[model samples]
Target: MKFSPLETPLRTIMTPGPVEVDPRVLRAMCTPILGQFDPAFTTIMNEVMEMLRQLFRTSNRWAYPVDGTSRAGIEALLCSIIEQGDKVLIPIYGRFGYLLTEICERYGAQVYTIECEWGNVFAPEEVIDEMKRVQPKIVAIVHGETSTGCMQPLEEIGRACREMDILLVVDAVATIGGTEVNADEWHFDGVIGGTQKCISVPSGMALITYNDRIEKVVLSRKKVERGIQTDSDRSILAAGKTIISNYFDLSQLQDYWGPRRLNHHTEATSMVYALREGLRIILEEGLTERFDRHRLHERALIAGIEAMGLSLFGEKKWKLPTVTCVNIPDGVDGESVRHMLLHEFGIEIASSFGPLHGKIWRIGTMGYSCRKENILKVLTSLEAVLVYHGVHVNKGEGVQEALKVYIEQSKAIGAGR
Candidate 1:
């Protein structure tokens, strides 16, 4: 039997994650492979760290991408600092928040939680109040809950955590590159980001940054692997408590990324290239500009959806700009519409999870997929599909409203010029 060369359909992905990777990033991934520790490749690694620092808006000494999806970075950070029976506070507003709780529990943390309704985020006062009550060693929260398209405000929580001297860990996977994540000003001890969502890169890397406050805890749990231990390392080996997973150990991974250059697992070369290029694209456009772009597209998408007689699912103020949640119209099969969008239009949008699964459709205007062309495509296609399903929508109104947004922006730019 002979296997053919791999091929996949061309799709316009309008999902919460794994959105379209930028063409530039895809080209970068095709660059010839280099030895992971070669001077040239290491230079690229250092560049990636610096770029990650800029992307996260942090002055952190440690900024790098882990070799797995977004969850890997979250797990590494939690496992490194959380010892058995360490008290942890997780505020769950969506599915990813529960993911943090699960990771913490697996690492033997005694987890405490505060939860709000799925479509709403907790007030800063509520979270701060919980922190005072629970007084956990760490507070983990999601900056953007893509599952419900709610973005929790973090500044107040961060300030409160600092005042209480509890480490504040944030999962900013969905909001990092697409929105403002001031890691330092927000007082986050650590932040984990993903490549696939707003970074316009493939889904193989998880970016992380941590200030010295978290570093102190990670260093306290450091243990050097015996195989690669130098004489100096041998002296300090096992001096502190050892982290549970060797592969996910932040302490050991640091040495490999640090000047000591101790060998850990081989790095994922192509993904690093993709990440570097992705970061460069973001920096080239500028962070503020990129954020504005995401917001602009999101506004257009929302305008179109609302004009077509659809209702948005989450609170307007707390809604995530990258992922928009639209209510599934009454008497329409949400999944069938999605199927029509995919099979008939070659467009892919996501459905919600758990209670929201059939009640809402998640449309993502994220990363490279967040643009005028794709937003219009989704709006027009969705309107057509809804009409086919016998839903009464304002014919042509969806595209019309979306075009108004774009036209207004263009006029504003012209006036500025």
Candidate 2:
């Protein structure tokens, strides 16, 4: 086969994450590259940090992007804080929770888990009860479970953990820019996010924030290894054992971001540019306004899906606005319908993992892809695919219902004045 310019299909990405990137961010990445330590590049980095602070709604000076994907930031937090045999309690509701357990175990942390149904979130009381029972040093939870499209209530859980003096860590990769998450107000020790989900950027950088309390814990436990030399002036003491992994070490990374400006690995230049521009868009729109857009689009999508006689997989009250899980109709092949939508209609949705693999489809309305036009287009195409698969969906009902929602919302806004 001969390729001209490596053309790809124009897709409306409705998957859980890596939603469509804004064209402005895309264009920003095309600018000429600069050296990692260049003064101009460092200025750009500072600007990115300020934008992230505004987006996360936190005033901590430790806010910055990790050099890898979302999971890298998760690893950085766990590997730095979790010493061998330390107790960690993880409340597992979806696939990412399982990932947390696995990463913790890799660093020799003793992992305990409380399991919930795939489509549900853990109640605050349940989490508190588990904390009392386990008395672990750390409690890890996912604010938004992409696999199930459920949003866990963080305010209560965070408070309970703080009262007990347990460190709280949250995976907010799917929730960060799309929902209302105040890192400081909720008192999270550490929160991790990514550029893909709500920031509408390519997936390369991960963002993590740690409060002073968590930073103190990290500093107190530092120990110098047998062979490694410690700089007398450095604030972070090296662990006696070799740092869990060279690339993921937070001690060196902290120094790099600190006033010391120590050299570490070279940061990804293009990704930094994209992340900076992506966060600029978020701050310009204002975090609250962006969140409202996501919520409205989610409600409209739900209305349309329900009008087509489909049931949502998760509870209505706890569902994440960024991603929606819908049960597959009986007698319809879920994978077949997804393939048809992608190959024929240039749309991409996702199938769930683990227990929900064949049972549901995930439709995402996040970042730049969360728009009225995209929502209507996906609903119309999905209706066609369902009908083609011999599922009993009312013809043209999805789009019509979505339009009705838009009209109702317009009237409500008009009446508010």
TM per candidate comes to: 0.96, 0.94
Runs of candidate 1 exceeding 4 Å displacement: 223-241
1-417, model 2: which lDDT tens digit per residue? 876997777999999888899999999999899997888988888888788888788997778889889999999988878877789999999999999999999988889999999888888999899899999999988999999999999999899899999999999999999999899999888999988999899998899988887776666454443223557423233332334686877777877766677898888989989999899888889899899999889988998999998999988788888999999998889999999999999999999999999999999999999999999999999999998888898788878889988888899899999
Check candidate 2 and list the clashing pairs.
Answer: 223-238
Model 2 clashing-pair count: 1
Q: Write the per-residue lDDT of candidate 1 for residues 250-334, one digit (tens) a residue.
A: 8888888988889999999999999999999999999999999999999999999999989999899999999999999887899
Clashing pairs in 1: none
Off by over 4 Å in 2: 1-4, 221-242, 415-417
